[model samples]
Target: MPQIAILQMCSGIDPDANLAVIEDAAKQCAEQGALALFTPEMSLLLDRDRARARAWIESDGPSEMIDRISEIAAKQHLEIAIGSMPVATAGGKWANRSHYFRPDLAPPITYDKIHMFDVALATGEAWRESAAYEPGRAVVTVEDTPVGRLGLSICYDMRFPALYEALGNRRCDCIAVPAAFTVPTGRAHWHTLLRARAIEASAFVIAPAQVGHHADGRETFGHSLVVDPWGEVLLDMGGDASGLAFCEIDLNRIAEVRAQVPALANRRPIPKS
Candidate 1:
């Protein structure tokens, strides 16, 4: 069993500052024998002003955060999964993406968030993520990792069962859902959605979340979760504060759960309407 760390953060507008937080957290996680460290969404920048954030984003060149992460991963022989960052791309649009970096700092396996959160919530909070980001076209899974094969998804993507189903079909042993979710939705659905995904896929689910109020004037519900293949909540860092939590991951649990449930193998497509 390998221990994994989840860094719950309260990121603000400054990318450098956020990167510092991650670097420090990574060092701590590595020293503590964590195989991998997962961060919440918008780990680099969490600003309400999309234009301001885009101005700070990078298309190419040596990103300070990535560089620091590379050094940390190589030095500690750790695996780091960044929840989301603003990546400049074609047409002058940015993609909200997650990046997976290994001990060798091999070119990161990146996954752009496929589901754009465009909704006005009952909490009077409105987020038009599509306005700032282009939805990703590909579903990504990284095969080489200390933990078994890993499937990648961002915050909002967890709402779509089909995505998890697809990852499960690919036989992913673990799924990462990094998020900066609102209080209302997180309170009501965080645990339920995470546990459901794990149970449905027979895979371990790791979710690191942003917590507390940020400089953007928006608040995020903070309850970083580590769920088992059997839908058991192994660890839940409560919403009270931001910090780190560790969980031991046994890939054999996935096989055990799948053998008993056999849910993934029983799936049948519904008739097209």
Candidate 2:
């Protein structure tokens, strides 16, 4: 069993400030025997000032936060699951990427977010994420951890069940869902979507999220969750402060649930013209 720590944050415009908080959280979680720590989307900076945020963003290289987290992992002998961070690409667009830093301090495994959130909500707020973020073409899974084979997904990717199905086919035992969900949509579909994915894939679902208001003046619905293979809510960190939530993972539960349910084996293709 691997002990996982999910961290919530209301990140601001400053990457250094955000990293300070994350460093402390990492130490605390490491001290508590957590093998891995998962952080939320935009864990580096959530600046409302897009231009300023871009000024500070780096492309395909190590940021100060990334370096710090890698050092933490090396020193603490911990594995880290970094949520979504905007990585500048050569095409002048950014990619929402999740990074897996192992204890060995070697090159990290990364997954670019496949889905982008571009919505005009009824609440009178609009976001066009595609303008800045490029959607990835590949689905990534990493298997070199103590926990189990891990599938990576960002916020909007959770809305697509086909992605989870693919991960299921890949025999991944756990999935990371790091999000900075809007208040309205998060309230309506957060738990439902997460639970459904867990049941469909029969994998442990770990979600760390942004809470409260950000430097961008946008509010996020927290409630970071750790769900078991049987669709049980093992831990739910409420939507208030930024902190770490802990849970122990049982790979046996994944096999146990799949043995009884057999959803993946029961799949049938739909004929299309």
Candidate 3:
């Protein structure tokens, strides 16, 4: 079984500052014997200005932040999952992408967020992610170190259980939900939703979240967590703060839980209304 670490980030507009915070957290996780470290969404820059965000986005290869983190991963010989970033893609559109970096590889495997957050919150806060990001069309499941098979997703995808069910059906033992959840939604749905996904799928749910206020005056709920296969939160950092939480995952527990309950196997197709 692999040990995992989740990094809770209160990243501002400064990319350099965010990198520094991540470096510190990664070092701590490595020292704590974490085989894989995960960061929150918008790992590099968290600016609200669409124009400024567009200016900072990169087309291909590695951005400054990615380069720095890649170097760190190689030096430490650690696997990393970067939460999300705004990357310039083809057709004059940007992608909200999550990166998975292996220590020995020059380039990381990237997964663009499939679900775009284009909705109005209960607090009258609205986000038109489609305006800035091109939606991804593929379901990504990677066989990585420490963890056997890992599935990747961004914030808004949390609301959709079908996606996770698909991942579990594909034999994903672990799922990463890197998010910048709003205060209203996070407070109400964050833990419950995460736990439900874990219980339903019988997999470990590792979520590193963005908490506190951003440069855009957007408030996010920060309670970065690592939940086990049994829906028990093993490590949780409550409130808004930049820190690292470590957990030793027992892979066998996943099989045990699934064998005991087997709800996933019992799922049936429902007729469309």
Candidate 4:
């Protein structure tokens, strides 16, 4: 069993200010005895302006946020999972990337977000993420620290259950979904979807979220949560400012839940019409 912490952030346009907040949250989580700490999407910057956001993105290795967080993780001897950042990738498009860093590694194990939010919301808020970012091709599951086999995903990916199913098939014990969910959608579907995913996959779900208003006037639903395999809410930081939420996850509980429910084994294919 390992203890994990989720950092709920209300990020503004300033990268420096956001980093300072994240640093403080990480330290607090570490002090609370959390072995691994996770952050929300666009953990460093939440700029809606395309040109300005593009300007802040870096090409090769780590960004200032990554380096700083890595240093902090090293100092605290904690494993850090950054939800997602905008990074320069091939084809002149940026990637919405999630990175996992251990105390020993200078670089991180990265996973680009596979699902892009390219729809017109009911509120008439249209987002073509593919216009600004490229999509990741593969599902990523990695092993490091107190939790054994952890799967990584970004915001919009939460709508796709098959992705999580794939991870579960690959034996992922825990899943992280760092999000900046719109207020309307989050209010309706956020908690239910997270709980369903946790129950279906028999894995602990770590969801660090962006709360409050962003510089772009986008209101994010901020109920950052950590749910267990049995659909229990371990920690819930209810739409607060910047905060840390912790949960002790027993890896063996995954097996226990799956054994009781046996839902994973019951999933069978039906013939297409």
Candidate 5:
């Protein structure tokens, strides 16, 4: 059983403050014997004001925040999965990117969030992620980690079953769905969708999340979850606060669930309409 840690955060507008939280969590994860530490989306900064946040968002070369995280990972000798951050692209659009940092000299593996969250809510809250972020085109997976082959996806991507289907097809052992979800949406769909994805993929779903009111006047639903292949909820850090939580990944459970359901093996490609 490999134990992993999740940092459920109420990240603010300050990048340095966020980095301090992560650095402390990394130290704690190392001390607690965790193989990896998973954090919520926008772990470094969660400001909704694009103009105010523009200064910290990285474009060319590695930003100080990224360098600090890399150093932290290396120093702690622990794998750290930074849920997502805003990174400027060459195309003049920013990317909501997830980065996986290893303890070794190996380079960090990154996955740009593919699904853009552009929606108008019943609560009158609206988001236009596509208006600023460049959507990713590729499906990314990293091999030989604490959880075997790990698939990467961000907040909105969890809503699209096809993305999980693709990850399922690749036989991932665990999938990361880091999110900074709004209260209304997270309440209605968070657990159900995460469990469904875990069941469908026959894999563990690790989701670290943002919780409580943010500095930018936004609130997030934060039941940071770890669901098993059998769709069992292993851990749920309630929405009330920000903190660190741990869960053990039973690697054998993957084979057991797949052996029972075998959904991935039985999947047939659908004909185009």
Candidate 6:
């Protein structure tokens, strides 16, 4: 059984304050024998004020905060998955990117979020992610990690089954669906989608989420979850607070569940009309 830690955060506008939270979480995860620490979307900064956020966004190179995270990983000898952060793109737009840092201090694996969240809800809340962020072009998976084969996807990307299908095709053992979901949508669809994705891929789904009221005056539905391959909810952190929790992932469960259902193997491609 591999142990992983989930850090549910109510991130604020200041990047430095958020970094302190991450640093403490990394230390706790290391002390508790967690191989990796997974955080929610915009783990470093969650300001809805794009102009204020732009000041902290870096352009795919050496970043002070990122470098500090690398140092933290190196010092703690732990893997850290920063769910998503704002990155400046060469094409004059920004990318909502996820980064994976290893204890060995090698280059981090980066995954840009593919699907943009553009919607208007009944609650009078609207998000137009595509207005500022560019959608990623490729599916990303990292092999030989603590969780075996790890697939990566951001919040809105989880709504698309095709992305999970691609990950299922790759036979990923676990998928990370880090999110900062709105209160209304999270209440209605968060758990359902996560469980469905786990069952569809026949793999474990680990989702670390953002919770509570934020510094940007937006509220999120927390309930950070870890669902098993058979759609069993192993852990639910609830919706009220921000904290760190640990879960033991049994790698053997993957083979057992796949042997029982074989959904990934039985999956047939749908033909276009």
lDDT of each: 0.89, 0.87, 0.85, 0.86, 0.94, 0.93
Task: Output the better candidate (2/5) by TM-score.
Answer: 5
Which 10-residue window in model 4 sums to the lowest lDDT?
55-64
lDDT over C-alpha atoms for residue 219 of model 5: 97
Q: Could you give candidate 5's per-residue lDDT for residues 1-273 as a string of tens digits?
A: 999999999999988888899999999999999999999999998989998787667533336667788899999989999999899999998999999999884668999999999999988999999988999999999999999999999999998999999999999999999999999999899999999999999999999999999999999999999999999999999999999998999999999999999899999989999
RMSD of each: 1.4, 1.4, 1.7, 1.7, 1.2, 1.3
Tens digits of per-residue lDDT, candidate 2, 1-273, equal 778888999988878788788888889877999999999988987865668777777632336657777898898888988897778887879888888998887877899999889999999988888988889989899896767999999998999999999998888899999999999999999999999999999998999999998877899999999888889999899998888878899889998999999988898887998
Give the least accurate 10-residue stretch of model 6, judged by summed lDDT.
55-64
For candidate 4, write residues 126-147 as lDDT tens digits.
8799998999999999875578
Query: Which residue segments of model 4 deviate by more than 4 Å?
Result: 58-62
Q: Give candidate 4's total backbone clashes.
A: 0
Better of 2 and 6 by TM-score: 6
Whichever of 3 and 6 has more lDDT, that candidate is 6
| Candidates arranged by lDDT, highest first | 5, 6, 1, 2, 4, 3
lDDT of 3 by residue, 48-120 (tens): 7887666567533337678888988987778989998778887688888999988886788888998888989
Tens digits of lDDT, candidate 6, 115-148: 9999999999999999989999999999999999
> Which window of 10 residues has the lowest lDDT sum in candidate 1?
53-62
The reply for model 1, stretches above 4 Å from the true place, is 58-62
lDDT of 4 at 12: 80
Q: Give residue 196's lDDT in candidate 3 (0 to 100).
A: 88
Give the clash total for candidate 5: 0
lDDT for each residue of candidate 1 in 1-273, tens digit (9 for 90 to 100): 899999999999988788889888888987899989999999988988876675677534227667777888898788999998888877667888899999886778899999999989876888888886899999899896767899999999999998999999999999999999999999899999999999998999999999999999989999999999999999999898888888899989988998998988998988999
Which ranges of candidate 3 are over 4 A from the true structure?
Answer: 58-62
